[model samples]
Structures are given as C-alpha cells and as structure tokens.
Target: MGRTMGLDYGDKTIGVAISDELGWTAQGVEVIRRRKPEDDMERLRQLSAEYGVTNIVVGLPKNMNNTVGPRGELCIAFSESLRESLRLPVSMWDERLSTVSAQRTLLEADVSRKKRKQVVDKMAAAIILQNYLDSNSKR
Candidate 1:
C-alpha cells in the first residue's frame, strides 16, 4: 500500500515527512525551500512519486482559541492546491503546537541550536504526521 505524506507548511519552507509502508510511523524527509508555486508543486510531485505517497496531510496552525488565523488560512489554501496538483486525498491536521513540541524534543535531546534550526521543520512535520497516525489508528 502507498504511504501517507505529511507537510508542515510555512512562509519560507515546507517540511516533509513520510509514513512507513504499514502506516505506523512517520520519518522526517526534507525541507523544501519556497519559491514559485509551480516549482513547489514540481518538487512535491517528484517526492510523491519517489515515496509512493497516496495521501497527504497538511498541518493547520490554528489559534489557541480554536479559530483559524491568517496562517491557518494559508495552510488551507496550500492543502487545496496539493489536492488539485497531486490528485491525492489531502487532509489537514490541527498542529497548533507541533513546532513547539518539536523544539522541546530537540532541546531535550541536546541538539545544537544550529542543528535544531536546520531540522526543526522536518521534525515538526513528523510530529504532525505521527499525531495523525495515532489518532486514526485508534478508530
């Protein structure tokens, strides 16, 4: 079966993660630098093909008050674009604290600040994907 892909969309980059074949866990892949929309789509298309991604999950960073903010709106738009361009089932997961959690994990592991900066986005993507997988597996 094809695996699920997770994306942590941001202003300057998109963090990527891929689920295992059994859909049990997620691993950080790479961080895609933002450029033109078409360029971003092309990169995603290539990654999808390479990883046999059948589904995509985009992180939606909502406000603490349970409302979608400007950032969340952007994520929704990105998710729509992914659905149209990739022709894959795209979903959004609440990721209000995903990045923060990633940062905390990195700190706990004693990752250097420079290294953490380089990898936080991808780690956040993995956190988002793992959260989604855990919730869905309970169903």
Candidate 2:
C-alpha cells in the first residue's frame, strides 16, 4: 500500500506529515514555506512522488462554531490544487483543536515559545494525520 500525507496549511507555512509505508504511524516531515500557488503545487507533486503517497489528508481550519472562514476557503483551494497536480485523492479533516493540542504538547515538553513557533506546524500536521489514521483504522 502507498503512504498517506497530511497537511496543516497556514498562511506562511504548510506543515507536512507522512505515514509510514506500513500505514501504521504518522511522522512529521517538513514545513513547506509558501511562495506561490503554482510553485507549492509543484513541490508537493514532487514530494508525493518521492514518498509514494497515494492519498492526502489536509487540515480544514474552521471556526469553533464549525463555520468555514477565509482560511478554510484557502485550504479548500489548496486541496483542489493538490488533487489536480498530484493526481491523488485529497481529503480534508476538521482541525479545530490540533494547533491547541500542539501548543499544549510543546509547553509540556518544556519547549520555548520561540522553538514552539518553529515546530508547532509540523506537530499539528502529525496530530491531524494520526487522528485520520485512527478514524480510518476503527472502520
């Protein structure tokens, strides 16, 4: 089976997570610095190919009340772009508390605020992907 990728899309950075080839665990991969849409698409396409990823789980940032906002719209657009460019099944998962969880995790780990800023995105992506994996595994 091919691996799955997770994305935590943000305004400045897109955090990436990749599942193991066995499809068991999720690991934070890298944070892709956003430049242009076309360029980011190309980079993702390359990463997908490199990792043999066949599916994607992108985070959809929704308000706590479950309303889609501008950031959520951007995620939708990014998912659509990924589907078109990577030719993979790109799905979205609600990521309301992922960042909060990430922050808490960093705090518990004694990570400084500055360091947390650097790794929070990747950790959030890992959390997002792990949640998806667990949900699908329960099926």
Candidate 3:
C-alpha cells in the first residue's frame, strides 16, 4: 500500500511527514520554506511522488474551544488546493496544540532554542500524523 503524507501548514513554512508503507507510524521529512503558491504545490507534488504518497493529512489548528478560526480556514483552503493539485484524498486532522506539544517535547529533551526552531515544524507534523494514525487505527 502507498504511504500517507502529513503536513503542518504555516504562514512561513510547511512541515512534512510521511507514514510508513503500512500506515502505522509517521516520520518527519523536512520543512519547506514558503515561497510562491505554485512553488509550494510543486514541492508537495515532488515529495508525494518521491514517497509514494496516496493520501494527505493536513493539520487543522483549531481553537481550544474547538472552533475553526482564521488559521483553520487557511488549512482548509490549503487542503482543497492539495486535493485539486494532487488528485489525492486529503484529510484534515485537528491539531489544536500539536505545535505546543512539540515545543514542550523539545524543551524537555534539552534541545537548544535554535535547534528547536529549525525542527519544531517537522516534529509537529509528525505528532499530528501520529495522532491521526492512532485515532484511525481504533476505528
């Protein structure tokens, strides 16, 4: 079976992660620095092809009260664009505190501030993907 891709889409960067072929776990790939819209899509397409990704999971940063705010709207738009461009099934996973969790994990590990900044996005993507995988597995 083909793997699934996870994305943590942000204004400045996009964190990327990929599931194993069996779709049990997620591993961070890289952070794509945001540039042009087309550029972002192109990079996604390339990574999708490279990783044999058949599905996509984009993190939707909802508010604590479970409301979709402006950031969530952006994620929805991005997911739509991914669906249109890649012709793949795109799912949005609620990621209310995925980034915060990532930050805390890094801090607990004693990761340097600079290093955390460089890797936090991808780490957050992995957390998002892992959470999605876990929830889906029980269904």
TM-score, per-candidate, Cα-based: 0.98, 0.96, 0.98
What does candidate 1's lDDT look like per residue over 25-125, in tens digits? 99999999999999999999999999999999999999999999999999999999999999999999999999999999999999999999999999999
Better of 1 and 2 by TM-score: 1
For model 3 the local lDDT of residue 135 reads 90
Q: List the residue pairs that clash in candidate 2.
A: none
lDDT for every model? 0.97, 0.93, 0.96
Best by lDDT: 1
What TM-score, to 2 decimals, does candidate 2 have? 0.96
Candidate 3 global lDDT: 0.96
Single out the weakest 10-residue window by summed lDDT for candidate 3. 128-137
User: Which model is ahead, 2 or 3, in terms of TM-score?
Assistant: 3
Give the distance in Å from residue 121's predicted Cα in candidate 1 to where it truly belongs. 0.4
lDDT of 3 by residue, 78-126 (tens): 9999999999999999998899999999999999999999999999999
Consecutive 10-residue window with the lowest summed lDDT within model 1: 77-86
Q: For each predicted model, how many residue pairs clash, with residues at least 3 apart or on different chains?
A: 0, 0, 0
**What value does the lDDT take at residue 11 in candidate 3?**
93
- RMSD values, in order shown: 0.6, 0.9, 0.6
State model 2's lDDT.
0.93
